[model samples]
Target: MRWERGRRSRNLEDRRAQGAGRRTGRLRLPLPAGRGGKLSLTSLLIMVGLYFLIGPEALQGLGGLGGGGLPGGAQVGLPGGGSGDVASGPLRTTPAEDELVEFVSFVLDDAQQTWARLLPGYREAKLVLYRDTTRSACGVGQAQMGPFYCPGDEKVYVDLSFYGELRSRFGAPGDFAQAYVLAHELGHHVQHLTGTEARVRRAQRSSPGDANELSVAMELQADCLAGVWGHAAAQRGILERGDVEEGLRAAGAIGDDRIQGMAGRAVQPESFTHGSSAQRQQWLGRGLDSGDPAACDSL
Candidate 1:
């Protein structure tokens, strides 16, 4: 992709220096689905009731309601004093990663620019670049979770190393593929801005049994919104010949079914929170084909 033609954003925050001794925190339990990664009131009440019923000992055995600083029991953390001296100086990276950083800034700026024009009352969300682990309003963010947008703090968190996995493991190598990850997270920010996030969370609470399904819809919508950004980017002629295909490969590569298979787990639709490979490709295609944000209504 022609990322150089895009603008750079001043809202980028570099926190890579403070990533040495970050504790790798993981969620050993489940969490309330939807609304990014916050604990819902209903989940809290259930936890309180459980605490009263079983005491702390048994609760801890059950992973303390996924309290290992993960979202629904995923790894989450940021480097603090425990992680050696957190870098306070400017981050210097290898020539390759430096280019990646610039690409990220450009993509973020482009996405925000598009949203500003497409949506009313849109505010550009900030991006935070960190490594190893980082604290986010959503949960403890580790590279394992890839790029995530924290609705709680209105910021996007990224560990650049995840790009290595995206390229090597997912087999979706390209600048556009990397940009798609950022766009997807930014799409989450769009969801937050439009109040779709809150509405989804409320819906989840109303039907706990369907929480995972709702979460999948939310994720698919974000994917479609990401495609919307791609549409806008393409309109400006930044997209190259294989860019769309690269993005589609990326969408399929990270589908819940693919990820589960990669992890050696049996494919189970009931447990899917991010849809299947085909579903992701379809929604992403919908947004890219129409160039309309409304076309991304996966919910």
Candidate 2:
């Protein structure tokens, strides 16, 4: 991607120097019981009840809730200290990491600008750059969760170290891949602004049994929205050769099925929260091919 000349976003909040507060007790959700551990209707109703009582925050760490960069939105925190290691001193970064920060800033601004033009009264969402852990309106965010958008606070949270894991562990690498992660999170911001998110939550509550399927649709739609931004960036000469491929690779890398396979678990389509690899690639490619948000109505 040709991003050095791009504009930096003013909505960025760099909290790397600050320490994360002390760890809080996590609320664990019950796993599905019975055949293949499928969530029983009773279990589903229990989660739905929790949702009504505590809002989405109650489902913060739950995989398939569309809160993280990866399919399950995994949350991993460092042990000891409220702020983790950075609490002891200022954060350090290599030149490459510094450049990565600038790159994300550019992507944030560029993607928001695209939305501002595409959607009326579109407000910019802030991006919080933190380390190890940070407090979000939804709950505590951890590095292992990858990048996520919290609708409660209308901000995107990201830990840059995840990029290294994305490259090495996930087998997805390239600057555009990193940008895709941010774009997808911002797509959640768009959902929040347009009432799509609220409506989905209502639907999830009303039909608890369909919650996972609803989440998959929501996530696929976000992938399409990200591709919509990619389309705009390409039109403005911001994309280069292989950039699209990088984004697709990133999308495929985090598919629930692929992640499950990586974990050495059986591929369970019924349990998928973020859809399969083919589904994600298909939706993302649809937006890229059409370059129209209308073409991205996966929901």
Across 121-215, the per-residue lDDT of candidate 1 in tens digits comes to 99989999887666765555556556777777899888776677677777889988898888888888888999998898889889989888888
* Per-structure clash totals for the candidates: 9, 2
After superposing candidate 1 on the true structure, give the runs of residues whose Cα lies further than 4 Å from its correct spot. Answer: 5-8, 20-92
| Superposed Cα RMSD, model 1 | 9.5
| Alpha carbon lDDT at 220, candidate 2 | 91
Best by lDDT: 2
The residue-level lDDT of candidate 1 at 4 comes to 73
Write one digit per residue (lDDT tens) for candidate 2, span 1-299. Answer: 99874345699998876553422213346676658867889989987775564454543533221323343333432222243333435555556767778999999998999999999999999999887667777776666567788888899998776777678778899999999888988888998999988888889899989988888888898899999999999999989999999989988888888888877778889888788888999998887877788887867
* Residue 119's lDDT in candidate 1: 92
Give the 10-residue window scoring lowest on summed lDDT in candidate 2: 61-70
Best by TM-score: 2
The lDDT of each candidate is 0.73, 0.77
